[model samples]
Target: MKPTSSLVWLRRDLRVFDHVALHQALQDSAVVHCVFVYDTTILDALPRRDRRVDFIHASIAEVAAELAELGGHLIVRHGDPATEIPALAAELGVGAVYCNHDYEPQALERDATVARTLRDAGRRFLSFKDQVIFEKSEVLSQTGGVFSVFTPYKNAWLKKLDADPSVLAPYHIEPHAARLAPPPSPAPALPTLAELGFEPSNLAELNIPTGMSGAARLFEDFLPRIAQYKDARDFPALKGPSYLSLHFRFGTLSVRHLVRTVRDVMARGAGGEGAPVWLAELIWREFYAMILFHNPHVVGGAFKPAYDAIQWETGPEADELFAAWCEGRTGYPLVDAAMAQLNQTGYMHNRLRMVTACFLIKDLGIDWRRGEAYFALHLNDFDLASNNGGWQWASSSGCDAQPYFRIFNPITQSQKFDASGKFIRRYLPQLKDLSDKEIHAPWLVPRMLPLDYPGPIVMHDEARKLTLERYEMVKKPGPSADQ
Candidate 1:
């Protein structure tokens, strides 16, 4: 009898343990070969000193080392995945290729091409759900259609998990000893960042380590704070957010394991408000993923077409406003501080994300897509789905988005969230001496001020009036049809 040879192609899900596709390949086949392709399609479009690329490179190195210790080596390739996967499969004479499902628009298209190439070569192509607990149409409304809203989808998701909780079981990898074949002659060298026309980035300086080990460390550190997550997550002054989002984005952390842990705590009534709230955040993650899957158009366009009717600031004025927003000179301390946090650390708190996003689209009358793209360039944990969803949500253009007239008052926000101005002072050191009451709106303070600090970039009242006028141009005095 011949051994069933299969190739395990790794993408975002980079870990060896508790990986559904990897574990399945090891169990169902005799020899399981692992491979990671540095997709040229994505890399070529990125800037030379992209931190995401550096993060991926470091993560793959960790993965390769782990697999090498188990008597197998990861075959690294650089090119169009559609070409590389089939070429490697032929070289290894593998009967099938297995991988986890990816929901991004580009990934789906790339996978389709790879699937076609593999099928032409008479090889089996298999993909499994390993990332999200519920995907595609898994958790639907009673009428049997995809859910556009989150609450009902979440209720359905919880109900499904309660009925069949075994789906969250850990998939321990058991690689066969004799399965790893001898290396092919003249193995290709793993391409260096320089070779790929990418320069060195300050990924280490950001203190965001890559790989499963790093993910484990972060998750462990976050567990003690899980109980207080609901209260602490909103305040930027505190170290509250799990900070594991980057790990989750890159597939270093397993979604199934997270869901299980969170659910288990909730079941025991131990997590309190934190459990349900954090779980809601996770559901938001899943919801955004599902939204991306269902409406791939949201990647570049508005989720609701009516939003496209809303004209944005253009010409020189738009550029000026965008520049102000990006440079942390938007006059709003919380907004400025949030932008600075994103620019300096590549991470922004959830509350700040909402506040700044609203400030950009509503206060500045800028397009939500502009802010979305800026975030895409800077965020370390930037997922296209979540970023798009968040930007659209802030702009009142996405499904179940905030009401158009319910604009966020930046001054009020800073006062409520960062009462002592500690968060603002951390990022805007020049404003360190401001009183707690005056910190939210520093222009109102007296002459006792920092010499270096600039005055308010744009008057909040005028900006708010301009925003409402801009919105009125698109909408009349009537209820929105989508609502």
Candidate 2:
């Protein structure tokens, strides 16, 4: 039976078009109302000034404006989603409340509470897979178990896509536009940053785009260079990345749309290696999501339980080192510069993310969780699963992680990727006057040593040895030991 009235609850999937929950609600109801909640449970824990909050606020405004044009008004509420969603659904007398899935543990718990409350009221709470292409146990191994590694999982993902290409099809909502319901009363204004207990961030000055239009603008710019993604993606100085992570994180853009576009380009042989490489990245995201879903313990512990036994640096010295790393005062040009970019823009290049993360775990010998939490607080595109997976990968405590024995040489990495020192110079202007050769390690050039830049925090050679010893403690016993 069709519902006389249904409510569509918008979460990360912020856009109007190609949205599963919205389409589903419109399909089953004569009248559909849209809503977005500023969940204070999540917000109260964050700092007063956050770029993500600003970005979300701006995007919600866009959603409200767009919905108004579509003959519907968005109901913006500020409260715990668990209470707010059920309360709103009851007030609207909705037969069902539709929303997209959220994979995070906290979100799952919150949803469970909302579901119970809605069920008690005799209203249905329905959620659809709208974030990733495949979720939970969707793309399991042949043995019917969740795959831990990425490559095999990626292969399975590709095969599944090949077999069922319809998975990438967009959920067109325009046809059901006539079902949208106007606001019950005057549309409540979106809460201001101050009203929400958050100060204005530099998101506007950074010019990082927001909303569907902003996402489209970025995608249009990225399409031309996607063919070169494989070769250009590694160098931090170049405009290589799609810069759509924020869009993806917030669901301002649809994953299906991106995958479909890339798949079409690959079929035409226009994407070259870049298309497949970029597609693999998208798969990596799903892989992490699957990891988090299957192994929820990864939120607080290592994927390989044995890695938890490895002791990290402690006491005042360790805290001092971590502070240096966070402040961009570590004196390793590449690592420090990467931190500076993250602190200033709330964005860091992919290559730098690896280098910096490796430096934190391998060089500083600090706990990966510390760095992970720091990133969770700062990164505008912070998705818990991906961020946690990345930190674990760098710490050699994750599935398919880099071997602990193979530590990165910070100087060589800087020299190789930022060979011309363009990226370093951009972030670390103190070394701007130095030549490319000298910019990589200013300490090596005695004349440049005493410049504004601090000296190397710790000798790489010594740190590498310390890291090897630390990891050795967790090494399995040799054959002789058993004898």
Candidate 3:
């Protein structure tokens, strides 16, 4: 039997169009009320002025306004979701609460608590898959077993999609939006930044677009250049990436729509060689999410258990090296510039992410977790699953990760990707006058030249030799004892 009334809880999936939870709620209930809670349990850990908070603040306002235009009301609350969601549903006299699924371990725990609370009150808590097209055991090997490697998994993922195109079909919203209920006589006003105990960040100053409209604008701008993505993405000075990660992180954009659009463009023979390559990148995102779902231990320890046996730098000297790397004073031009970019802005190029991660783990002999934590705190597009997977990949501790012996040489990486020194010079103005050749290695410049930048903190050759010895435990091929 359909419920008389229902409430839809918004989490990462913030938008209204093609929203599964919202669609299901409206279809099943005579009247529906939408809500979003500013979860303090997660927010209290963040700094006072964070770009992600600012982004959400702006984006949710747009969602509320859109709902109002559609003759629906959106209730905003600020508190722990475990308490706030059930409380709001109770106050509204909703018989059922509908929401999309969350995969992170912490999120799973919170959802469980909410579900139990709703059940105790004789109300049902319903959840559906909306974040990813395939999750859990949906995509597996021919033997119905989980695949550890990416290539084989990706092939199976593609084959499954080809067999069932309906998975990409979006959930309808307009047909059922009329079931939305109006606000009560006294509606709760949206909370201010001060009321929420957070300050405004520099997101506005950076000119970063927010909300569903912002995502649309970014996607439109990138379509013309999608063909060049494969060749141009590695160069930091070039505008190659779509720059829609922030929207993707917050669910302002739909993965289904993105895939459908890219495929349509290819069907018309418009996209170049970059089309297939970009599709593979999208698959990589799902692959990481799948890895996290099965291996919760990757959050604290290594994905490959044997990697935990390796010793990392400790004590004061290691601390000093880490500080230098964080402050962009490592003296390696590419590494310094990458760090400077991340510090100044919340975004970093994909190539730079790998370069910096490799340098921190291999060159400085620091643990990858420290670097992963730093990125998690700073990045606007930070997702725990992807961040942890990336760190493990750099440290040679994850499934299908780079070999321990394959340490990246920062100097050659800089020369190959940013040969003109344009990217490095943009972030490190002190090295602007240095020649293209000299910019990559400022220490190599003539002694007569006055340079303010510090010399290389650790020589690449010496660091490489030390790294090989440090990772000696995992050199021989063997199964993970702990796993």
Against the true structure, what is each candidate's TM-score? Answer: 0.94, 0.97, 0.97
After TM-score superposition, the amount by which residue 23's alpha carbon in candidate 3 deviates from its true location, in angstroms, is 0.8
Least lDDT summed over 10 consecutive residues: which range in candidate 2? Answer: 474-483
For each candidate, the alpha-carbon lDDT, in order, equals 0.85, 0.91, 0.89
| Clash-forming residue pairs, model 1 | none
Model 2: per-residue Cα lDDT over 1-483, one tens digit each: 667899999999889989999999999999999999999998999989899999999999999888888888889899999999999999989999999999999999999999999999999999999999999999999999889889999999999999999999999988888899976575667788899899999999999999999999999899889999998999999989999999999999999999999998999999978989999999999999999998999998999999999899999999999999999998899999999999999999988898899899989999999999999999999999999999999998998887777677889999989999999988888788889899888888867474578998999889887888888899753221100
Q: Rank candidates, TM-score, best first.
A: 2, 3, 1
lDDT of 3: 0.89
Query: In candidate 1, what residue range of length 10 has the lowest lDDT sum?
Result: 474-483
Q: Name the regions of candidate 2 deviating beyond 4 angstroms.
A: 448-450, 476-483
**For candidate 3, lDDT tens digit of each residue in 1-483?**
678999999999879887989989988999999999999999999999999999999899888888888889789999999999999989989999999988899999999999999999989999998878888789999998987899999999889988997888999888887899876677666788889999998899999999999999999998999989899888999998899888978999888888888988888888897777788888888888899999989998999998998899989999999999998999999999999888878888989999999999999999999999999998999998888988899999998898887888889999999999999999999888889998888888875444568999999989988888889856674332110
lDDT of 1 by residue, 271-330 (tens): 878878888888898899999999988987889887798888898978988998998887
User: Per-residue lDDT for 370 in model 2?
Assistant: 95
Q: In model 3, how many backbone clashes occur?
A: 0
Q: How does residue 448 of candidate 2 score in lDDT?
A: 41
Candidate 1 lDDT (Cα, 0 to 1):
0.85
